[model samples]
Target chain A: MNVTVKTFAQLREITQEGCFTLTLPESAVTMGDVITLLKSRSDKWSQALGASAGSENGSVLMARNQQLCDIQTHVQPGDELAFFPPVTGG
Target chain B: MFALIGDADFDQQWLYNRLRQEASQKAKGNVGAIVTFTGLVRDNNADGNILGIELEHYPGMTEQALTNLVQEAITRFSLTSAGAVHRVGRLYNDEQIVWVGTAAPHRAAAFEGANFLMDMLKQSVPLWKKEFTRDNSRWVEVKASDDKAALAWLREK
Candidate 1:
């Protein structure tokens, strides 16, 4: 299964791209798994993903298909997943 | 009322011209004053460092919030037409951050309408600001002053 993850703000800088697609196995998955996978890819993800000390609980907001979602939400193939820091705009 | 998700810069001249055109199109009634408010990004914060600012918003929620605010303003004050545009992404110091333009038959109405748009936008809009300093970055939190301003409007209504 492939998921296209959209990154914004701090996450975008860490990923160095607006969005990227990743293949996940057809097994049970959670936000924690995604973070672990992302961290394994590079130190940037490890730091920005909150695997590093002093990071804000990863504070990365999650949205599945444009609607805000919790970390436990079930994700399927082709799902549009997004990660972003706390939004600050007016 | 209009909202957009893009990096387009605001042209004051063009906006003023459009507002005049729309006002005429609406009616030639004794409309007196047009009130406009523009928000810009500043370089300094409490930390006293100079840098840029970044704005982020919830896509769907942002449009919905602005629409509701415009409707509320119209109900509060008999406005002809009110519009606002907010910029997203990284912004340099002194860049136009947001704008609110209101047209009404009287100064009071136009003034109230423009104020309503800005006050409500700061309080209710699901947008956030991040201040970038030379040494560090911080999320701009909603201030008590904003709450007081928004509350004052509600009290008057």
Candidate 2:
């Protein structure tokens, strides 16, 4: 299955790419799996998406198909996933 | 009238006029109060003078979130109408960053509704801000005060 992954704001700065496609195995059914896969690609990916260092300031926010979700949230093929920093605009 | 505008300046007066027109149409002259709030980009943050700031948002989600917030404010406060406009992309200091307007039968409802919109917007919206200083730039950290304000609304219920 292929999923479209997006990074924004500071995460984008760290990742150096705003959007990309990731191929996942059938066993990888959740956002956590996607994070784990991306984190393994490189230290930068780990630093940006890792659960511990998530971002410089705080935990990264995740959205599946533009709706806010958690790592445990189930994902499917062709889903759009986003990771970004905490919101500050008003 | 909820929108996530990019780099384009918005007219607060137009939003106010629209709210007034909507109030008159929806309530038949019953609305007695209309309130609006505008957020400006400050020239400085805790670090010192800021040259400007860049705002980024998740495109599709941002629009849906603002629309949902406006609808929620209207339903919760029994407002006649409400609108919110947020700016994205590079913005200079003192520029208008956001605007929110609400109309209701009384002053209290209108005031509370506008307040609710801003408080909720800070916490729930997907937009992020980055401050650019003369020598450096950094992402604005989420303030605990903002969380407290947003939570106060929930506690009020």
Candidate 3:
């Protein structure tokens, strides 16, 4: 399965990569699994995605198919997943 | 409901008239009030010595989210029409950043609808603002005050 992953704002700066594709294994069930996978890939990704800062669960916001979702949300094969910081615009 | 996500400054008179026209066409001059709010780029934030700001947004996601907000405002406040226009890209101080307007048969709903749109927009919209000073730039973090404002609306329902 494949997923389109995107990062924005400070999250993009931390990841050093804005958008990309991720190939997920059959074992992957939810968005949290994908984040865990990315965190395991490299040090930069781990640090940027909030995994290392101990703010991974709450501070970071996630969206599936462009709508806000929880990490526990189920994933389809080609879902678009985005990670971003809390919004600050009016 | 209407929403526009662009870099150009929006015309306030046009928005008001458009909303009024839409509502009148729907139900013969029933719109009694139209509340409009415009957010401008101030010269200062927490750091006093600010130059300008740059706004970033999720192109497709932003439009969808804003459209949903406009629709929600119209329904939640019993508004006849609702709309918003958010500016993006590099903006200088004293420039317009955003606009939200709501129309209803009464003044109370119009005012409340506009307020709800703004409060929700500050937190839920996928828009990020970066402040620029003489030395450097930094992303503006979400404020607890904004969350409180939006939460108040939700709890009332």
What's each prediction's clash count?
5, 0, 0
TM-score of chain A of each: 0.82, 0.88, 0.89
Question: If ranked by DockQ, best first, what sequence of candidates would result?
Answer: 3, 2, 1
Question: Model 3 over residues B1-157: C-alpha lDDT tens digits?
Answer: 7899999888889988888788887767688888999999999986586888999999898898889888889988999998999999999999999999898999999999999999899977889999999899999977655544433432332
RMSD of 3: 2.9
In candidate 2, residue B129 scores what lDDT? Answer: 90
RMSD of each: 6.8, 3.4, 2.9
B17-85, model 1: which lDDT tens digit per residue? 677667767767755778888888877877686688877775665676577677678678988777778
Ranking by lDDT: 3, 2, 1
Clashing pairs in 1: A88-B128, A88-B129, A89-B127, A89-B128, A89-B129
**TM-score of chain A, model number 1:** 0.82
Q: Each candidate's DockQ score against the native complex?
A: 0.15, 0.48, 0.53
Record all residue pairs in model 2 with backbone atoms less than 3 Å apart, i.e. clashing: none
Q: Pick by DockQ: which candidate is best?
A: 3
Best by lDDT: 3
Candidate 3: which stretches are off by over 4 Å?
A51-57, B144-157
Residue lDDT tens for model 2, B100-126: 999998999999999989989988777
**TM-scores of the candidates in the order shown:** 0.62, 0.91, 0.92
Q: Residue by residue across A34-84, what tens digits does model 1's lDDT show?
A: 666777778777777674311223355566665545566677788887766
Between candidates 1 and 3, the one scoring higher on lDDT is 3
Docking class of 1: incorrect
